[model samples]
Target: MEFWIIVALTSVIVTLAVAWPLLRAPKKSTELTDDYDMRVYRDQLSEVDHDLARGVLSEEEAKQVRTEVSRRVLAADASASTSAAEIRIDSSRKTNLTALAVMAVFLLGGASGTYYLIGSAGTADQPLAQRLSALQTARDNRLSQKEVETRVGNITEMEDKATDDYKKLVAKLREAVKQRPDDLRGLNFLVQNEARLGRFAAAHQAKSRAITISGSKATGTDYTDLAELMIIAAGGYVSPEAEAALAQAFAKDPEDPRARYYSGLDLAQNGRADIAYKVWINLLDEGPEDAPWIAPIRGQIADVALMAGIRLAPPPPLAGPTADQIKNAANMSEKDRRKLINGMVRQLSERLASGGGTADEWARLIRAYGVLGETEKAKKIWGEAKLKFASNAKGLGLIKEAATSAGVAD
Candidate 1:
């Protein structure tokens, strides 16, 4: 009602402003101009008479001047009469009342009609505080891990297509872990296999047990892994349980890349895109290109940036293992593959040691050694990287991610 009142008042004011001039009586400008000309010509005629009387002009010259002035006076009188007739005719005609009425109607009615058709006529204003409060409420009421898992049923659609041999192997691993619950190695193996089989709930349970067994020795990576598994189990939702695990991971290591990435995701999910954009952008800048979290961050950061009202250029593609290399590794015998990977790792290590590669390269080397089960080598390279990038915060962050993945950093 208030909106309509304001709109109606504005339309009326604008219409009156525009139509005010047209609504007034027309001016007698033509008549006034003719009258002034007639008066001037009459004065000229009188001057001609005076000149004749003062002997300043010949009789014939005076007569000629008088005739010319008289003719001009007559012409002015005729013009004034014509102008008066035109004015009388104009007065007889109708005023612009109809046109003014049409204008007012168009201005008021057209605006109201258009607004009624397209505008949010009855909606209330959503102030910033209200919007933020609503988002906070949504975040508070978001589904829990179990609830989300229940909503996203049949999480193993793809895993159900696994070959008989793979299924049997996973079953055997599950039984082994069940029998040797305290064996961290078996538990780790069970978590990996369960995740591969799309049994993320089981994987997270195994990971939780592993974290409990390690107790004070558990790293941020361990908690991050558990959080990641919970997210996967919930079909990518960062549920409350997953958020708690992520909080634990952050408590362990603030710069843990996986934990930080998931934290950003949680923020984004909860409608805090501004903070999420900053978090993800820092992660992108401080990156080992092959970090597991890097790909997803790259994929979604542009959208998050838009939500945060930032215009972000798409990041350059990351350099990583090629499809052909991955396919080749899949075909290689385990021994041969290990030899190939070891050769590659040796080359990278030598290059970094001799040429002092970028932080990304140093981080990659650390991750590679970790994957090769060379914890001592990974730790040594991590130490060297920390010294090499001592003053560089971004470089140190990247190196820390690799170190975390390699179990060489807290």
Candidate 2:
């Protein structure tokens, strides 16, 4: 009741302030007119008399000046009445009143019309509440369905590196996963996208759920991904849980590149460099030449290999056996094929480190280092190559590309 009273009072005040001009009648101005001139003439006659009494003017001269002034005043008085009447504009007065009424209608009508179009008047009695509510409603309506999904529904939406299209895909995947939480396909997307999105915690959770859903079908890659996520989530520290995940991955696929790489890393940290050396050297011999993990393997393998009575070779150029090469060696066993590949890699590395290859070759060597996850070695090579090719723009460009690929560019 008090609110209503306040509102009613406010409305009355606004109405008066807005329409006062239309409601009031026009008043004539109190300016100098014929009547005023009569008074002014009388005052001048008195001043002339005072001047004569004080002997400032001769009696005759004062009288003559007063007479002339009186005559002019009478004429001015007649003109003043006409001038005053001419200023009274009845037509203009009516026009102004009408215009004021029209303006008041527009101002009040606009306010009411705006309220009716978007206001919550029909829903509630509180007139002021709609103003705040409208703002919130507008903001809520601004977000597209896809935007909402990307911001909240999908874990991968948080990844800074993900493309907008990719983020949308992740959002759709999130919706699908929500609908079927037990689906392996959904969980797989959840794992991969989440990791790519850099949300390691979510990635680990998704990987765990995936393993649970997959049961015995969960592959080494899945477990490895989970372990890697765990390591990342723990800020590169291989926690006990990560250790467990790594073991599980090894159990499923002992030859998994990432799994073997991380295992070697852990082993080296645990003062088992000899074992780590064996693990990495074997990975180099069998793993895909372009694998991301191989760079790190090739980089750190040297120290451990030396400690384990083995020579760690320099990184080879980024190349692997061609289909033709494999076909030519088809008569050889799988072990032989791998051995030949490893030997080729070893030969290339030796040439890069000592045989003084071309600028392109050096760049290839750096790229190979990157592929093997040997960022430090790649950086070192980059420094040396810069000195060698400082004046050569083409060579420098190649080296820059290689360094960038290796994750070693300054």
Best lDDT among the predictions, by candidate number: 1
Model 1: CA > 4 A from native: 18-26, 29-106, 154-163, 313-410
Each model's RMSD to truth, in Å? 13.3, 23.3
True lDDT of residue 249, candidate 2: 92
TM-score of 1: 0.60
The local distance difference test score of model 2 is 0.69
Q: Each model's C-alpha lDDT? A: 0.81, 0.69
Clashes of each: 0, 7
User: What are the per-residue Cα lDDT tens digits for candidate 1 across 1-410?
Assistant: 88888888888888889987776755455553446777788789888888999999999999898888888777777787878777775764445777887787888888888888899978889999999999989988999988888876544534765788999998988888888889999999999988777688888999999999999999999999999899877766789899999999999999898899889989988889999999988987887776666656654666678878999764443355678988899999999899978888888786665445667778889999999999989977876665445334567788899999999884
Clashes of 1: 0
Note the residue pairs that clash in candidate 2: 294-372, 295-372, 295-373, 295-374, 296-372, 296-373, 296-374
RMSD of model 1, in Å?
A: 13.3
lDDT, candidate 2, at 198:
59
Q: What tens-digit string does per-residue lDDT give for candidate 2 at 350-370? A: 665543455677777788777
lDDT of 2 at 48: 93
For each candidate, give its TM-score against the true structure. Answer: 0.60, 0.37
